[model samples]
Target: MATVTRTTRADAPERSRTEHTGGGLRGAVAAEWGKLWTTRTPYVCMAVGVGLTAVFAFYYGSIARINDEPVQAVGKAPIASVILLQFIVVVLAMTTVTSEYATGSIRTSLQWVPVRHRVQLAKAAVTGAVSFVGGVLLGVLGMAVAWVPFRGHASFETGEAVVQLLSIGTYLALVAVLSVGVAFVCRSAVGALASLFFLLAGLPFVLLGPGSEVLRKINDALPQSAGDHFMTGDGDPYPSLVGLLIVLSWAVAAHLIGLAVLRRRDA
Candidate 1:
């Protein structure tokens, strides 16, 4: 006389590790970190960071010793080397998203964590945090090499040097986070990098055309050209803090755009 309906397993939702945020994201972050460290690209980027710092520092400091231009030692040589290495780090950061597409793991990632923004935020947080640590290490190691060649703090004024070191780390962190945001927007490494090259390399030239002193003067207020402030201790031509704020604004704008795209587009 009793008519009971049977619940079919096929219609059931997939069971996740948690109903929602409840410690799942933390576990995901931990797992993501393991993936990051075990991968070759990240460790290679770390090595490049350390190697660039040491090799370029020694080269620049040696040049300084020969030319007796100790002040320009790290500025001229080490900054270029650091920039090159940081660019590679940025590429690696971009791959955080692209790699999932390449391996077809993104579907599973999305399924496991249906809330899309949370996934992107977690990935960005992990990459940015690790990149910042790497940048800090690179700054310290480069300073060490420069100091060693200078006969143990010979040319490095202690207080000023610490300021430069912090600035170096902060710049690298911003670059890395920006790359992560770009990658999320583009969803392709090559596309994201092409866009970045335009922003960092092209924008400055376009802003400061030849024989346009007035335009160049105001445009120089932008972030890319003003990036040199960290390496230059003299009275910077542009406002250093303003440049930083501009960079932050760019990051925020780019991130919001990417978030909107992620919301509208299919994963």
Candidate 2:
């Protein structure tokens, strides 16, 4: 009777432990959402991205007459908003892990989730979801508000125009997830951010806009180049899907490398 009772007790604790981990994953997700909404990054990014997009649209709308084709000018507004809004998305994305690294809170995060891989995956998921929703809403609304002034020029209600707004959101989310992957791989605040900013801004300019034809082809195939698809309706030089895949691949590779490092390194 004593032996049987002891085995039953041990099994009870094992069952409870499994249940605890399941509960913990949910807790982790909730914590992520809380951190995102409460943290200054998301709020500021959304505000700046949305506000600037609106401002740019209005500015362009005001000068629509400057264009030889006024109605056509309306088409560029969505593109302009997306290009401008991505800047803010990049900033928030860098913050995803850099901020935790800067404050050393990531150590605590690892401690809480001992299985570091799960934690990082959870972080990536949260970041992507938050960024996508925020970016999409801001881009769509900003363009819509700007559309009021564009009334005399062109129809804003077109399907292509709708895709343009939604694409901004998708880009923002993908960029944020990529940043989180960057944060984990670099594991240093300043270094990660410096590299993140360069990739987001400088790299593309060097490869696509100013460099040689070879550089243009290389850059155009990259995420920075691929993102242009979201802005322009031009039939893809390759395929817009190609760019998105590249971005996802980069992010996945980084994430796996980071997971390896997290598993081996002392947090």
Candidate 3:
């Protein structure tokens, strides 16, 4: 008779660990991608973001038409709506990380990924890609809705509109990465959201009042301000390229800091 072997509980965990660790970055990314779409929050956030974009576009576009405002640049028509709806993007990204922690699923994620940095990278990659696609769609939808109201009052330059849409996508992608980093650092939805809210929205207004040149300079460098400059093709305090660089720098810095925290902490 051939020798027969029985598997024990202890052997099962080791086998599972080996299996999970074998896939490396590809596995981590695939796991994150599945986790992102396998929930209701992402869908809700996307629907709400799209709904708000339409509402804001129609409201602002109607006002512009009724007021008979001067012919506006088609590329800039969605800027305001995008800015207002950005928090939705933040919430979506934040939830990707924080919800795992909330549900105690992060432990399982860490077990599967093992390398914490890879997990962070995977989350960032997934969130950024989704945000970029969502941003582009939002840009297109906002412009189309606004165009209906603007009718003959909008100047359509294909090149400018294309640039603006791509810029919106890039900007939102960076914002999503930044939010992921913050979420990793905070590990709590409320903490990350409050921090990002202050960084993206509140701080700018606080510093916008008549004050020192230093405060004004700080305001110009803030991520949202830089994003606005880049998206709207505005060149006042700095060029759009410079604005893009500033946002990129912030995202990188946030990622590094979050990676450090992840490395030092327990799951």
Candidate 4:
């Protein structure tokens, strides 16, 4: 008879545990980065965003030129593009989380990582970094495209343009983080998108439309308004620093809530 050997059940769990801990946070992040690029969603989102920005920039530039707007700042030329790009960024970030849930691949992800918080952190890091870079590039591209129609109508200040580009990057990174957190909480793309839409656009409009001082004050404190003030370097109701803090606070709050939910919920 041939000799036979059987592995004990205990050995199986030990091997699994070792495999689970081997990857850790670094591995999780690498995996997330891979997932982000391997899919078509990121590419689609980026292409659509770039196309929309170019179109909007040209339109805005033409309008400014036609109106003979007096030397509008180049930094402000991309404002319209930024508004539309926010939705694109949010969709991209949310998909990172929601897509996995939609396809039931989140279970496999959890199995590989085995640490929920690490998974969340990895997703946040990847999305935030990608959004920041995209935002900066889009800002520069928007300005360049708009300048075609705004050759004589726009004023360019290197310092101001740099500040605006950096601000756009910072704002989009935070917005990406906020969208990721919301995705984890909702676990459905439509649900998360609706919630973010209200927070980023609809609520601001409703509050501002009322034309009440209290409502206006509340709107100013929202993430969208705060981001606007920070990016534009506005100092009307509050300083830029305060505006940044407000946006940061919203991002942090959403992340914490999502983390808590991830810990308690089933994958």
Candidate 5:
């Protein structure tokens, strides 16, 4: 009878451990979501992004309407917004992890979750989802608001516009994920953001500046330059697939490095 009681007690602990292990990632994801919305930063950033998008869309749309250039207005409206919105997305993404690090909450979080990778994955997932939604929402809103300036006369190539919209949203999500990875590796918001800024915005200009043809060719291969073709209308030299692969490579590499760091370091 004593042996049977001991066996049952040991099995109970094993069952509890198994249950927690199975649901741990899910719990982390939920915690990430909760943490993200609890702050004012995300809301403020989103509002600023949307506001800028609307203002730019209205200005461009008015010009197109006066010029009687519906196609250009319809096509470029959302994209113009995307250009400015990327900065906001970067901030939101980096904050997802950096905030925890800044406040030293990461140590407590690690203690609770234990699996570092899952925590990173959860943060990335939440950031990606939020950025994707915000990108798409603002893109569509910009388009709709721009159409008002056109007074129902603006025409769009529906299929192409749809594709571009999807591509823009997905691109923002990827950038957000990349930012989170960078934050994890750098563990400092300012450092991570500055590095990403150079990677996404600054380096492209330097590479494309007056220089050798080799430098020009290298510029075309940069993630920013390559990704610029994603939502921009036609006549790009680089294939869409190539552009996607280039940007995706950056995001993947950052996350891989971050994962390695997380595994090797103490939270």
Candidate 6:
């Protein structure tokens, strides 16, 4: 005699739900990734981002010998390049979400993956992963090329330089994720770009302007300041850990708010 056992959905509701959620998330991620790469925007953005980094790295290296301190050029090359490339990252991230809404594909997306949170998480994951990998490649390339000007000489500590490279890559990726969240909240490419410009470009300048010491302290908490601190190895306003936490907190808060809004609204 043989006994056969079969599990029913009601009998294992928790397990069933967990499996369903996991499957849905994977499907959503794959779908988002496929959608993202199927177009030319991501490719163009990546090319521009890395291309600009290469240009800046070459420029820095070319002038490295002219400066009184050539080591400063080596240290600044990679990070400075990334700072300029961040705008492209912002546009890429914003377009990822806004394009869907613009084409009215969002309704179909919602229909396919009814779980709004999963969709949002999938998009964020793709954006973050792509940006992080691109940033790392760009940073490494910039550093390698910048070293050409130094002729193997250095003014900065090797350990710190290595740390800064990793930090800059991380900062760029975080910025991309933050931009993705902002795009979700804005739900429009133009609006999101305006918001990103204010947050990434305008705010830092305004905060850094001649003002009270209190304003300077507040400026340290801004995302650009955090990125600058990581880039320049400046631990004055906030420690590396604190600066990362500040940026990460903003990213998390933005995503949470966007998710809540997505859940409440129609596609």
Candidate 5 per-residue lDDT over residues 80-122, each given as its tens digit: 6676788898999898888888999999889878888888888
Worst 10 residues of 3 by lDDT: 74-83
**What value does the lDDT take at residue 125 in candidate 1?**
72
Best by TM-score: 4
Q: Compared with the true structure, what per-residue lDDT tens digits does model 2 show for residues 51-136?
A: 78778878766667446354763456756666556667666766767787788887887777777777877787788787788766
Q: Which ten residues in a row have the lowest lDDT in candidate 5?
A: 1-10
> Candidate 2 vs candidate 3: which has greater TM-score?
3
TM-score of each: 0.79, 0.83, 0.89, 0.90, 0.87, 0.86
Query: What global local distance difference test value does model 3 have?
Result: 0.89
Question: 162-185, model 4: which lDDT tens digit per residue?
Answer: 999999999999999999999999
RMSD of each: 5.5, 3.4, 4.6, 4.5, 3.0, 3.8
In candidate 6, list every pair of residues with a backbone clash. none
Worst 10 residues of 2 by lDDT: 65-74
- Two-way TM-score contest, 2 vs 6, winner: 6
Model 3 Cα lDDT, one tens digit per residue, 1-267: 999999989999999988767388888889889988999978998899889988888887888889998998765667887777689889989898899889999999999788889999999999899989998898888888888888777788888888988999999999999999999999999999999999999999899886879998999999999999999888998999999999999999999999999899958
- Off by more than 4 A, model 4: 1-22
Model 6 per-residue lDDT tens digits across residues 155-237: 55678777777787788788888888888889999999999889877987888787879888888888888778867767787
| Total clashes for model 2 | 0
The numbered model that scores best in lDDT is 4
Q: Residues 1-267, candidate 1: write the lDDT tens digits.
A: 999998677645544323543446775677567767777888787777777778887876666676665344343344555556667667767788778767877778777667777777767678878876776677667766776565422455567666666666666666766777787789887888888777776766787766588877755555455556644443556456766666667666766677777778847
Model 6, CA-based lDDT: 0.81
What order do candidates take by TM-score, descending? Answer: 4, 3, 5, 6, 2, 1
Model 3 scores a TM of 0.89
The C-alpha stretches of model 1 lying farther than 4 A from their native spots are 1-25, 70-80, 148-154, 205-211, 214-222, 230-235
How many residue pairs in model 3 have overlapping backbones? 0
Cα RMSD for candidate 6?
3.8
